[model samples]
Target: MTLTPQDRTIVEATQAGLPLVTRPFAVVAESLGLSEAELIDRLKQLKAQGVIRRIGAAPNHYRLGMTANGMTVWDVDDAVVDSLGEKVGALPFVTHCYRRPRALPDWPYNLFAMVHGETREEVIAKRVEISSLLGKACRAGDILFSTRILKKTGMRLRGKEG
Candidate 1:
């Protein structure tokens, strides 16, 4: 996509993250020497053009007492995976859930969900809850916890803007 100079300015200014304030857009606009309305309108236009998918905050769950994080993998029937995935994704404790291709003969898990807790036991309890929800559809499941914390960063738009 050919991004206008203003679009590039907006993306560069807010790509790091929106300001933590009552009027973040206004602050951003001031930085670019643009009006608040102009900044908001440009954002709406960007969304309409599909240049940006969505904007939201990603909180650090570990710092919030959720030290134990695990990605629970499930081997479910392909026929019912879509419905099952939707149900799992809607779960409050499930931060993220999605379907993935299974590598048979060696690996077989096709469904994945990420859940967090303060300890491994808590994460296991949450896994049990997920298993119960999956019921017989859950052919097999396992949780993979991280030994070290991972940093999450936003995507970067490379190259100079048009």
Candidate 2:
């Protein structure tokens, strides 16, 4: 999508992340010489136009004492996967969940959910809860534990050449 010069400036200014302050938007607006209200309005417009999906905090799960992270994959019946996915996504222990296309013979999982806890055992326990919820609809499943942390970042705008 083509962003206006002003919107481009806003994206460039805040893409790294909003300022770490009580009033982050106000700080960003001040830096860009725009009022806080104007910045918020533009952001809302961008979201409505599908230029941005969402604006929210990306917390460090490890720092929050959730060191054990596992991505649980399930081979759920395609007929009910979407509905079951909604239920899995709503569960308190599931940080994120969604449905994916199966790779057939070798890999059959179609439902994916990320669970976090302080230990592998805890994560496995949470996985059991998910299995219980899936019931007979889920045929096979597995958990892939995270070995290291990776930086999570959003899209960034390139600087204009002078």
Candidate 3:
């Protein structure tokens, strides 16, 4: 999709992530020299045109005392993966869930879900819950606990101000 220069400014300003305060869009809009309504309207247009998927926040779970983070991968039945993924994704502990293509001869996982908890045991319990939810649909599953912190950055768009 083609984005106007103003849309590029919007994307660039938001790429750094919104401020942690009430009326974040208002602050951003003012910085971009645009009204809040104009910014909202342009964002709606951008979304309608599929330029952006959705706007949301990525909280730092570590700061929230969620130290144990596990990415669980499953070899689920192809026919039931979507339904199972939706169910797993809806769970409160799961931060992210999606289906992925499996690599042959080595990797066989088709579904992935990330769960965060205050402790390792809690993460494991969440894994059990997911296994129970999948039942026999899950051929196999494994949990990979995060051992190190990686920088988390969202999408970035190139623009004049960027």
lDDT of 2 by residue, 98-156 (tens): 88899878899999999999999999999999999999999999999999867566567
Summarize candidate 1's per-residue lDDT along 96-145 as a digit string, tens digits: 89999999867899999999999999999999999999999889999999
lDDT of each: 0.91, 0.92, 0.91
Misplaced by over 4 Å in model 2 are: 155-162
The best-first sequence of candidates by TM-score reads: 3, 2, 1
| Native-to-model Cα distance after best TM-score fit, residue 70 in candidate 2, in Å | 0.3
Task: Between candidates 1 and 2, name the one with more favorable TM-score.
Answer: 2
Which candidate, 2 or 3, has the higher TM-score? 3
Per-candidate Cα RMSD to the true structure, in Å, reads: 2.5, 2.2, 2.3
- Tell me the TM-score of each prediction against the true structure: 0.84, 0.86, 0.88
lDDT of 3 by residue, 28-139 (tens): 9999999989989999988888988788877788999999999999999999999989999999889899999999858899999999999999999999999999999998
Candidate 1 contains a number of clashing pairs equal to 0
lDDT ranking from best to worst? 2, 1, 3
lDDT of candidate 3 vs native? 0.91
